[model samples]
Target: QQQKCKQYMSAELKIPTPHSDCKTACILLGQSLKSDLMCQFENHIADFMDGLIEESMILEAAPVSAVFSSSLSDKERGKLRHLHPHSQGKQFISRRSLLDELFEVNHIRTIYHMFIAALILFILSTFVVDFIDEGRLVLDFDLLVYAFGQLPLVVCTWMCMFLSVLLVPYNLFHLWCQSQSSSHGKSRLCSWLFGSVYLIYQTLGLGFLPTYVVVTNSFPPASCFIIILEQVRLMMKTHSFIRENVPRVLTWKKDKNPAPVVPQLSQYLYFLFAPTLIYRDKYPRNPVIRWSYVATKLLQVLGCLFYTYYVFVRLCIPQFRSNSLHLFDLRAMVLCVFNSILPGVLVLLLGFFAFLHCWLNAFAEMLRFADRMFYKDWWNSTSYANYYRTWNVVVHDWLFYYVYRDFLWMSQKHFRTVALLCVFTLSAVVHEYILAVCFGFFYPVLFCLFMCFGLMFNFIVHDQRKGPIWNIFMWTSIFLGQGVIICLYSQEWYARHYCPQKESSFLDFLKPRSWSCQRPLMADS
Candidate 1:
């Protein structure tokens, strides 16, 4: 029986084929099996091995196959399907948030409790300090009030943006679809009509309007951030809606099919409020809303807000607000950056926990959206590449699908490195825009870090660097990056308020004001 099985296996491999994939699989399977058991179950084993090879064998190229792969055309190479499991891109599943699952563990819960205790201590220390200084405990939220000023305008601006996004994209697409049934010339006219309107809406309506309002109003950091962040989110959503749907429209036109029914108005509206940037006719949803979970997450968000305020007031204010340090002096700047590291790291943690984890999860729960992976365990990332991917997975998904993959598809799967660089630049620019608008300056520190260090680390310190030392390296880089950002931005903020440029130039706007301001040019607030 063993001899017969061997002959059958040999015959199977000897069959003419385009490639040796199945032959290799068959050989490996025969060698891996127990020799003693193979004699008794030789026929069965042979059959099983043959079936496995048929199912699993695929044409995949590796380093060794580069010589052969080089001869394939760009079109052919782009069409080459990867059957390997690891090659598959993101597959989102309905699951609990990483933090939600982690908190169930006693060890993680204790760490959470420790943070709560620290918050309590901060509150007590503030009360005691205020009482000692003023002979009464001060409870006024002057800082919070100033930071969140012009709340009404922010709400109004967001409404206009959201309403425009909701109406403009969907209705314009509907118009375009209706036009498809008309004469070719008429269809072209309608396409031009709605297409131009959509472009104007995207450019003037979503892009310039919110930014103009924020800058014109001289909005405080918090208020400016709200408008800017919402603007970016809506723009991304609008793009995703169009990008994901336009292909279907084109396909219908190409196939000469009846115009497909447009996306339901309800679906578009739900997507506007949904946590995800990707548009779909439907999404995985929970059977019921967990109101308790929603409430808990929202409360955590509030806690983080207060936590940040305290950090800025206690650590940042006392240090940067001092009358002593020169804003631009080398020694002073170096000291400021190093000293700011602790608070910078704290604020970083707060921002991640507040927005990405608590805020997004809260909205997801309220909406019954079940794909709860807003972020992964980015803190455990040993490489910056893993850190970037794991950090804020929601945004990464949008960039990956719309920006990265679309670039590949457009470029015919060539210039992968170029595509990566473009993606990095766009991300950096958007981030810099956020900070530049919110803080009202053009420092470019974050942009430099992203483009230089970030792009380099993405290539160098990839997923393979899993040593404990790499984790330390990752943390150190983040800490220093955050410290420089906060220190430089804080200096610029104070400099702008203190040293109001009596008159400004294009150069002044382009240059960082913190570099020249040595002392207050205006009186204290």
Candidate 2:
């Protein structure tokens, strides 16, 4: 049958095809046998001819702008395609990370081994120092202990916030849906009352409770971080759940005899723990949880914690600890900034790997969440715009889908730049808020860079500028930016410690003391 099909093709083409070509044609013909064979063959021939003509035209019209524009359009389309909503009840398969898939490559594995070796060396150096100084190899973990102190309070606060988020939003949504379904005016009035009361309750539970816990308890940086981070996570989860389900409820109101499209409690509970920020009725899930993989990822997270501690102790503390503020000059500041670059970059990388990779992946494994794309190859980004979009994909997805897209909808697709600026502003404010709450200071170092310099870089160095040079520039900017943050924040932190204010005032609290701080002469001597 295959031979006959190939012979027929050759005869129709009025040519003696090669034996290998005939075999290929026969296979293609066999694959199309379920359809109308002649019709498929004719369609294939037409498509081939059309492609040839299109290629000829493209070659003739080969202008740089045209080619570049076409490529950019393709890239933009690919990104936009993912923005569309996923089909309900459809599951997707997750793809492995680039490094994970490339582990078979010797070079990739070698890099991983090198990082482990460096960690081992750091441990050895610490032990040697301890033995030499204290006459015994005693490892002190006071820093770690202090950092993670007051865990019970943090856990309790988080549980309270989670319960509010889990109960309030879902119940309020149900009330709203039921009111819409009823025709009676009393039902609508009751729904409005319930919603108003629920909003106030949420305001207290989600907003006031977390802030009160952080401020009233005088929680340390780590403890405050837990409350703030959980606060943000729960808020995003609740918003996503409502944002996704409200449209279905609205549609259900218009129908007469159909049941409401209410999602299950189990599904919402699973979503709360999933390693994603987007809400859907269903999501891609793995068939089974790999306990070994989960264990490995958790171990990596622990190693990263130690790596960060060492980075601060060796690289940051030594430089900032004993510096006399009176002797701080332009040259000294420059030196400090340059000295911090390496440590800052290390912190950035470690944080990315620790939280975005290992931490998320571990939770994903335990929860069987198959979509493991918590981040992308943001290090390879040639522009800040690309970097921001690719850096923390979980947060980016939330911001894009909820904030930016909603803004666009409100503006009726006009003023795209305004929408972009809104995203930048929201991100910068949240980041600065986190820093202020965690460190108990109002320094706007991160805010200035994120809103001002970051916004400038996003526009100036865009996706259009492609090449190795742009990539190098982007990385250099990142290094310098990180250096600035570390240098200035560290200096301010030390200055506040050494130079206690004579009297507390609002201006004094907001003002940076680093610029004016002066160490006593006897202390300096």
Candidate 3:
């Protein structure tokens, strides 16, 4: 049947026909085909010609931008193609893409945001654990070390100021050189060490400095988001070196000075200046996207329910049974667990709300300050990537535009993961420092190590390029696992370090406070 088809085609088409046995082999003009019978198949001239044209065109168009752009699948790229059918063959070039509209409807900014949300979750959970332990509701074993030992060492007054200064520049430069590197792991490790040491020194200064200096110094409050914003605003506006010479400023593209007209800029403004703007068009009519909003709201409702239940069990029920109950209420332990878990879980569930609130508020504050101060194009208003660039405006600008870029410079691959690790480590240390300063503990180092371990695990076990669900799962698992471990570790540490010895007076009772009436009468007589 094959021979007949070949003969008929050769006779009718009048084309140069390769021997049937050598068809596949004969096509290998530049490369050799080994002597395997199956490899020797004939090729029709027509199909070969068509395929050759496609290959040649692809070879001709292979530039770096083309390569990066082509990394998107054909369907993925199709969304960016000129929507107008008539616009075909004419390269459809829009400075921006509705990347959020296509596929899983995620923007690069959203992907960046998974990290941000995760960071916020980690921070809030840490706070909850601390607060619970402080209230003496739940046993936190690690609190004393974290509160007393670790933080003072990291956030010493002089050390914090010095390390902050050093870290700002070092992190900035690391981002700058990220693009040049070949091994992101090595670069990340280097940056991680440098930043960690800087933080350590900062803690040392802040911790051991003279009490006079510590008390009198006008250190900025870490909780004051506005203060951080103000500093960032001043830096962007007055500090030309940071805005210009500090490598890729985190706004849209590499060469384009951040333009307020960018979509991301508008979103940032919408989030910041007019928050209602976010809810306006985001769910104008889209059901699936709206469902996410609904899901978040549902979680909030459930969290409220749990929180209410916990309060009742811990406070109301205890009071109700106080008169009748003689033995220790076993249920109180259960209630404590619920109370701790409920509020912690609620804090996490409500995290998205806080994130949106903080981001929008922060964005507006940044823009208001940046516009009045820098007057430079400090905001970009397009793409999820640009949204990330504009919203935080500091970290994105520092890490992605600078640190990851530099990491890339030192080690060319693994830009995303390495950058992520660097940011995570810096955050863990800073948070630990904050908690340590507040409580006087060395537990932050352990916390940071635990975090780094989680990050490395995710980097190794999960393929980041996988779809949003996969990425979400990996993030959620790591964060949830870290929270659980930290809680358990803290409980154990608190039990060991902070647990009170039985009060000496309670045991000894050296003097009596009350005397019999007869003894008082005898003394008077």
Each model's backbone clash number? 0, 0, 77
Off by over 4 Å in 1: 1-92, 258-261, 323-327, 504-506, 520-525
Per-candidate TM-score against the hidden true structure: 0.83, 0.83, 0.34
Worst 10 residues of 2 by lDDT: 64-73
Put down candidate 3 lDDT per residue, 439-464, tens digits, no spaces. 22234434645476545553454322
Q: Estimate, for each residue in 431-492, the C-alpha lDDT of model 2 and write its tens digit.
A: 89888878767899999999999999889998787888999999998999899999899888
List CA RMSD, all candidates.
10.0, 7.6, 18.8
- Show pairs that collide, candidate 1: none
What TM-score quantifies how close candidate 3 is to the native fold? 0.34
Q: After superposition, how far is residue 146 of candidate 3 from its true place, in Å?
A: 19
- Cα lDDT, model 2, residue 129: 79
Residue-by-residue lDDT tens digits, candidate 1, 355-422? 99999998999988987878877898887777877898788888878777778789998998887787
What shift in Å separates residue 8 of candidate 1 from its native position after superposition? 26
